[model samples]
Target: MQIRLLDLLSRIKRLQEEREILRRNQALELLKTLKKEYEELVEERKKVSQVFTKSRFFKAVELQDLIRLRDSLLEWEKIAEKKLKDGYEELAKIEEELLERHKERRLFERLKEKEMWKQSEEELKRLYRELDELALLIQGQENKR
Candidate 1:
């Protein structure tokens, strides 16, 4: 029964480690996606700026169109910036959660170790008592002889 319990505890520890790894991988993927989006936004803003500048050489109607495009790009840039900020906030929360999980798993592992040590100590004591009894029986036989 003790061996079975110990095996169960070992399995639980392994599962916890696997879960932590999965969560870490997901967080990394999210961060990568956010970074890619942020980079794209930056590129789009640069293109808009170039177009706005080149509008100076265009006719009145084309210049007006370019101005509208520039305004729209500015609004999109603001939205993208907010999304990026939110992504960072989510990443921070995930990191904190991972840290807490690690601590909890460590606590459980320590408990399991302590239990194993206690069981071993008890087994050693039992063996010593058996040996002492056998020694007494041998001494009694010798005295009788």
Candidate 2:
């Protein structure tokens, strides 16, 4: 039973590591996509600025609308960046928890193994003592004969 527990613990640890690695890979992919988005937003801001200088088509009403739209997009991008950072922190917390669980499982397995060994040893000793007593009784009966 102790050995079985050790095997179960090992399997759980392996699964934890696999989950962590997959999460890290997902984060990397998101980072790449974000980088591309950041570049595109910079280009878009430049284009909007050029509209004010290069064209009379954007007057009071149009200018306000353009500015509002740009601001909203910028806010969305900031939120996305924040989420990316928070995702890393959450993953780190999960890793720490897994480490603690692994440690606990190892300690439990060691204690169980020690208990099993002691029980087997005590049983063997008791059997040996019984055999010795029987041998002594037989020898005494033969001497009387």
Best by lDDT: 1
lDDT of 2 by residue, 1-145 (tens): 6656666775676676667667667766776777677667767867877776788776788889888978876877687677667766766776676576657656666766776788789989999999999899999999999
Q: Which stretches in model 2 have alpha-carbon errors above 4 Å?
A: 1-63
User: What TM-score quantifies how close candidate 1 is to the native fold?
Assistant: 0.80
lDDT, candidate 1, 64-83, per-residue tens: 88678878877877877787
What is the lDDT of every predicted structure here? 0.76, 0.73
lDDT for model 1, on a 0 to 1 scale? Answer: 0.76
Superposed Cα deviation of residue 64, candidate 2 (Å): 3.5
